[model samples]
Target: MSKQSIVLEPVRCPDCNQTHIVKHGKSAEGKQRYRCRNSECSRHNFILNYSYRAYLPEVQQQISDMAINGSGIRDTARVLKISQTTVMETLKKKTLH
Candidate 1:
């Protein structure tokens, strides 16, 4: 039997819902850089290279599901070991969808 590779999807900013992001450059620690195209967004440049939080794809999915499940932002953040700001930000972006 051969094993297949699973491609993890890239995540977008919670401010602007556009996936038209591209590499702007690299951070000092060599983390990937991203630029949002949504003109309404104040956060044009971002670092996708978090040393701890926001590294896992599953975590992002859970953040979405928790919001849909009526969980409080702080509650979700505590349970998921993420920042409250991240939770709120992700939920805010999810609303755009």
Candidate 2:
């Protein structure tokens, strides 16, 4: 009997949930990056996993929520274990949008 090869699943876009993805290049941290081909997709490029906790969407959302709930920069930073600058910047950008 001939040996069978293992099949791997295709990468799906996190934004549009599409299968039209292509390898872009490696990130500065040597992590793999992928690009979405869907024209209607708002996402430019994304990594399946991020090395930094501050870069995670959930963390960013938490930052915004905490700020809305009257949390100070120092408090948020201490709780999130992220930089004060990151919390401030995220708040600024989030408020602007």
Candidate 3:
């Protein structure tokens, strides 16, 4: 069998929809990390393989809405039953744009 490398699509910011991201390195958990080039972006680094509902646009929007509604991080995480890290990450990206 021939070994092949899968070329993953470049991830765009859900907030700004920009492709100006760079591979910053890897996370401590060994996940592929990316950095948004937009200075206005709040998240300096993001892991591509984040666990939970990070892939869903609806979930991302909810994260923002909840935050705007004065929802605490722990509260959102608990209500959504997702990791607090995921909630924090989602909100971080939203404020960037």
Winning candidate number (lDDT): 2
In model 1, the runs with Cα more than 4 Å from the true position are 1-24, 33-50
Q: Which ten residues in a row have the lowest lDDT in candidate 3?
A: 47-56
Clashing pairs in 2: none
Q: What is the per-residue lDDT of model 1 for residues 1-97, given as tens digits with 9 covering 90 to 100?
A: 9999999786687567678788898877888888998888877887765776654556878988877788988899899998888888777766534
Better of 1 and 2 by TM-score: 2
Residue-wise C-alpha lDDT for candidate 3, range 10-51, written one tens digit per residue = 688755667898888876678788888888876566665565
Task: Assess every candidate by TM-score.
Answer: 0.50, 0.83, 0.49
- After the best TM-score superposition of candidate 1, give how far the Cα of residue 16 lies from its true spot, in angstroms: 19
Global lDDT of each model?
Answer: 0.77, 0.91, 0.77
- Model 3, global lDDT: 0.77
Tell me which of candidates 2 and 3 scores higher on lDDT: 2
Tell me the TM-score of model 3: 0.49
Best by TM-score: 2
Q: Cα lDDT of model 2 overall?
A: 0.91
